[model samples]
Target: MGETSLRRLPLVIMLLAAGCARQAPSPAPPRVETAAAQLPEQSSAIVVPVTADLRMLERGLDANTPRVLWTVDEHRDTCVRGKRVDLGIGKVKLTPDLGCRIVGQVTRGAIRVAGAGERIDITMPVSAKIAVRDIGGVLGETATARAIVHATGRLGVTGDWQPRATLDIAYDWREPPGIDIAGQRITFTSRADEKLKRVVRRLERDLPKEVAKLDLRRQLGDVWQRAFTVIELSKRNPPAWMRVTPRALGFGGYRIEGRQLRLTLAAEALTQTFVGRRPADPTPTPLPPPSRVAGQPGLRFFIPVLADYAQLEPVVLRTLRKLAAGGITLTGIGPVDVDFGKVTVYATTGNRLAVGVTARVVPRDRDFPATSGEAWLTAQPYNDEGSQLVQARDVKLAADTDSTAVDLIVSLLDATQVQRAVALALRHDFAPDYRKVLGKAQHAIGARQEGDFFLSTDVTRVTTGQLQVTGAGLFLPVRAEGSARIDYRPR
Candidate 1:
């Protein structure tokens, strides 16, 4: 055979073996690689076709569904997805703005992602049914509960045996009035995992706003210094509030384990005393005439605060040191007493104002150990900026860890701290948001300024014997959302 004829024969044989035509399988559609772009201006739109390997997609959704009685085309199918769906088959084009309308027998297998464009209206036979279809990231106003959703922003899990992923947002079943819905609905996006990555970027952009929130969180850590506080210190205290458990996973947020947080102070910690008038020598003064009893002497002087109220003992104490310096020899000491005559509340307009007092004092008896014959007073209020610090006078005192001459400076200091904390928590916790720190995020790219996309600002967690707060020392855990511009290029 001629050389040209020989080469032709070989080419024909190879094409037959390689199966490039006729019974040959068509090449798999090129993988879709969407380019980043501005969301939409006027009818900004883009198109994506239906995928062939869809049953796998359906299984992914089934795994996310809370419950299901789903059904796909019945062909003696050993469908482990087990849900049953007696529906027709077909494909619908997707767009960007105007959501594409779906019409046809819903397959647990069908996956639809409509960006923005004019809707694709599908027309199915009269017996039409669309099972559960979940369009994640496209929130519908009012309904996805806030159940302390424990989330691991970077990747972690803790729940029931079924690996509950950060992507279990499968579509709960629903249908339009005239349309039909199978027993249950479970449809997931093809790139549900990718959504998690987007959240990381979002968090990075939102870190700043959390500054106020973080301050409050830290203060709570300081105040509640309960089992979560300087754990090592708690160990030193012995018999402390023993609370240890797996902290629920959460990113860009602080979880208050449960409500009705209770706080209390110890009575044994207070021990101090004040002084009043009495005789120095234990010898009973020559009995004053009974007339004297009925006179000024008859006037029973009770200084309960000067000493133990229960033990009306007249003991010499040092609350009044200048009296000693004044050379006024007191042949007697006290039952130096005090009482709060009234309790009134002051606040501004709306009256949602909150004011509280946390005081630790020295008990009367042991309070003034040295020059223990003086009166102790207290009234410290921490107010907002440009606001007056409310002060209360003559608050009865007894020596305790957080008490002092100038209003139990330690306790006042603590109260001052707590006041700041409470204010921040109430003010910022309710109204502040850090997501905006990522201002003007390319809304054009369909990204939102939400906690979902929050990122941390260089922080690390050093476990405190298993149960530990996210950040330690002076830093707060912030959530920065969206992208940032770093000028340096990596080596």
Candidate 2:
């Protein structure tokens, strides 16, 4: 071969070698981070008021008691001593000399029921009239009497949430009726008293039947089911929800006010908060037998301040892209240029966050070739006390394939610039969200009606909790403590 041709062959070999180096295959993408975690459950209360209208008992009394309670009819003769005549028998037998006929009737007027502490008082007015027929031209007379039937009723709730009343009934005479003839006074109180005994028995038997009309069990059941709900704290930005699951039932006792009896029912529940899409409401369970509950029942729940991993991706990508725009310098390698591909953020084990970055890196150094692959980094995010700024510490770096090319890129990731950028992306201000959440929640808990029950709530205080990293996102638990009450107002 000629010398000039051999020289040209060397240049061609050099050009072919450069093309082969640039055509090397790119490394595979890194695997995403995985973690299993759940937010802590909190305790809360759902209070229900079961009310019974006592006017029903009044109507029942009016319907059950007859207007004409009883009637009395009797005829008797009393012998009168004739003037002392000559030859009159010394001890003449008491013979009928005066004829008397008495007829009487007892009738009820109106019934009224009123509340007295935990018990109720039922009162009814009664009137009686007696006519003594004129006999032997003896002046005829009519006697009238007034009386009142009084009953003391005690209210109670059964284990299964049934309302019942027990009545202690009796009657008192305001005016006694009687007749007077020849200094002989005839009283009808004994006969009236006997009739009252029967009336009292009937009232005692009928009170509970009237109380059943209150429908207390149905009211309580509606409250129990309504308590199992998911209350939305915020609609967007960071959609937050609080789930309530009733666990047990408690009896806070009963009170009589005006003409109604109110039974306080407290439901002990487990509350949990979530961020993102709304959570499903808990399935309602049957009303359980009430147990004694201590202290005043109040509402307690958590409102989570969350940062979804998907939301963090864009923020992190923007930071990385801006930093990579000017190119970054490594410790061992002098100056290297980087172009970001995709950024992924998610929770990892030990309450840490995992960030995966895909990039195509070019090195200015002669020994290192241009490389393209994904780099994985893990960090523990934390927020200082009374501060909203979140920063990361103990950042670790890894890759799918370990080599000098990947190590150079990892060194660039170790720079404070990248670390600070990630930390800045994690910086979440909870003040605005906190205030908005509280305001919305307060509005949500306002007095509202569900079925036949009226619900009301008052939030007194809120306490902040520690930060948690779950599979879904970064969650900060904010516990709200308050009081809640539900009244039975049937429509």
Candidate 3:
């Protein structure tokens, strides 16, 4: 009987060894699968159009110009040979001619300036009064004439941003100076027209001198320096900034409206966005020569909205836990419960995101062993253009364990429910941040003055780019588009 028992024990030992060999392998230890380092930051352009107001030039002309332009005094021979001159009182007979003296002055009125096409039209009013004496040696009378001096100023800017103009000056008498007496008229239009030529020459020479004093270079330099600084998009919450480093100046040309001359200077700059604290301003470079600008000029800048991975972890954990509340049914394994542990998210190469989840599977069947391991998943984050809602797409579950049971479980976890859970977990609504940033930008981008130069901007449109992940967090580049203008207001 002892020998038979020994034989049975040997068979039992063999069976036990077989059972040990059949047991599932131990689950791989939870690994911290780190994503690739964040990619290098890219930069965008900020092209702001600078509108220069030239109303001051008109005022300078008014201040520097003289009230009275020139005076006219002339005496000529009046002929009535073999003719009878009929005066209002009686007829006067002249043997040969009479000496006549005409003396008057052309007085200037208010200076008027208006924009016509690409040129500025300047109008100067003048009045001429002449006294005609010894008309036939019998009668003398006084006559008056009014005229307007017309000047067309072709405005231009030098390479150094100096205001320059070439004027074509001319004048016409509104009412010709003439004396009508004794049914005869004595006119002085030819003589007055000839005298006005001198006034035209004087104006053509002096007006440009005034325009040169506009000192647009100084004002433009101030604008260029101010543009080199940083602009705050948000003060707190997410603290974002845009550093503008001017690259070049572009001359789009000029236009005139009313008395204002607008010079379109496109300030081309390389703008980079920062998410955390304020970035240092870019060092100012010397204002470069004007470059030729193609396309329209406007303000373009990106406002980065970041969501820290640390902040997103808890949200993802909570979502995963909620989704896993009811036992997750594994195919051929019945209801398999899971206790969600920690969640780690980071950026990966190819603009993708890597998510690692530490989870312990609780088995319902005693025969099945409890398994604990991490499941590393990858996905692409994106958003629609101009939308603030960020969502995950192209989700893929990766196996990071050696145990066949755990791999099967992870395979089942890649089911629709788990994938949906992860997708929902990645759902981040940036609507509030978008509205706040836009509001703050619109308010902050308004009129900003430095000394006598007033810079104003009007935001016309807002756009958004693709979602980008970095070591810091998820960043959505929201761009603000608008037109900017700079005015020179001498205080």
Candidate 4:
């Protein structure tokens, strides 16, 4: 309490020597979650203790046998002594002989015991903003530490505390990077002793329980183990669920002019989050056009087409997300073309279905006779629709014996082919409703060409089992029925 008593306290002196003693290794590091990475709600905790050696202090000072130095040695005789701070533990009695020097103004509030050769000084308020790197054992040599502790400055205790009454204890020891004592306080309460015993007893029982719970946590803590396995595998290799196949059922020369490419996308095996209600897209409405581009040369045509750009899902099915979501987007393109006297365009996609179509084309000069009948254009002799197509009459030459008598037969044939094929094209554009579980209905289109000396004959037959191409992209329905009108100069 008074300056005289502080100086009277027995000092525990220590000196460290590199050749003899060494510092103990610090605790191991643990896993950490950065701000960028997501962390779970719970974390693990730890437990440890605090201890000190009165025996080692006595050996360092050789209290029983005083060392004989050079007779004139003034250093050890004039010991670096000062009024040291005493650490009292409850009713623990601090003997008045622990003489320690009060070192450089308790900067960090921790105590230090330093030894240089035979010179020993019990440094009080041992902590500092910068750490004292070199600290050997009490033997004053670099050797292993006889003891280690997990004490904190915030607990009003950081050094090796000697318990005159209460045993030095470390409870609920969590790895603290900084002095984060959530709520630790020391009160000279009358019942504090009773409270400490109760808390210690309860914690002794509850800590083992908490520790037991964490052991279970180490088991059930990671749910991503199985999920991430599939994800990582998919990153290195393709997933088994996704399969994409592309195909086209072309209508050959029956297309209005040059063949048009119509793309159809079919996806399957998708997560429920991305799937939504089926939207029935508007079919392309037909608009009439000129029989031929006046003063236009060569059998070339312009074809304008469109496909479903309206995405049904929230996120787009890119290569990455598709693999992540474990879904497939089957994409394919097909084409159908018919020759007019000039460039022509037929078949295009709207919001969902490729609906409208038109083509500008110029037929071959009428040196050859033109085929008659819708069946003739769709027939094997010129029906390129079949795999083994027989191009018997891909084109014919112009026979302008006169404007009226000259061959308009080729034009008639081209017109018939364009009509039937286009009807089929529109039918193909519609997509099946994805909402229902069942597949789409069937469809088909047939055409027959009839001819008379008076005018050319073009007949059409449309048939369909059922169709679901309501919201899908443009296509030539393999099975569908519909008819289209094509005239020879407005016959």
| Best lDDT among the predictions, by candidate number | 2
What is every candidate's alpha-carbon RMSD to the true fold?
44.2, 8.3, 7.0, 43.3
Better of 1 and 4 by TM-score: 4
Write down the TM-score of every candidate. Answer: 0.15, 0.65, 0.74, 0.16
- The candidate that wins on TM-score is 3
Error (Å) of candidate 3 at residue 452 is: 3.1
- Residue 311 displacement in candidate 1 (angstroms): 16
Q: What Cα-based lDDT does every candidate model obtain?
A: 0.21, 0.72, 0.70, 0.20
Q: Write the per-residue lDDT of candidate 1 for residues 347-428, one digit (tens) a residue.
A: 2112122122222222233222212112222222222332212222222222343311222222322333323332332221
Residues 229-333 of candidate 2 have per-residue lDDT tens digits of 988877864577788898888877777888777777777888887767778889999888878554446778776666668877898899888888867886655
**Over 4 Å off, model 3:** 1-57, 70-104, 132-140, 181-195, 236-238, 277-280, 294-296, 324-327, 331-333, 336-388, 393-399, 404-416, 442-446, 458-463, 479-481
- Between 1 and 2, whose lDDT is larger? 2
What tens digits encode model 3's per-residue C-alpha lDDT throughout 1-491? 57755555653454335334544432332333332122223233334434445556667777777776667667777622345688889988765555677777778887777775588788888898888777667657788889999988787777887777788888877898887755667787887778788777877776777776656678767777887888887886567777778777876667777556666676666767676767787999877877865545667776667777787789889988887796587654457778889888877666667777877776575444555656677777888887889999888765443442234346445767787788888888888777777887778777888767778887788777777776667777777777777776667
Candidate 4, 345-410: lDDT as tens digits: 211122112211112212232222222211112111112241111112222111222232222222
lDDT for model 4, on a 0 to 1 scale? 0.20
lDDT order of candidates, best first? 2, 3, 1, 4
**Count of backbone collisions in candidate 2:** 2
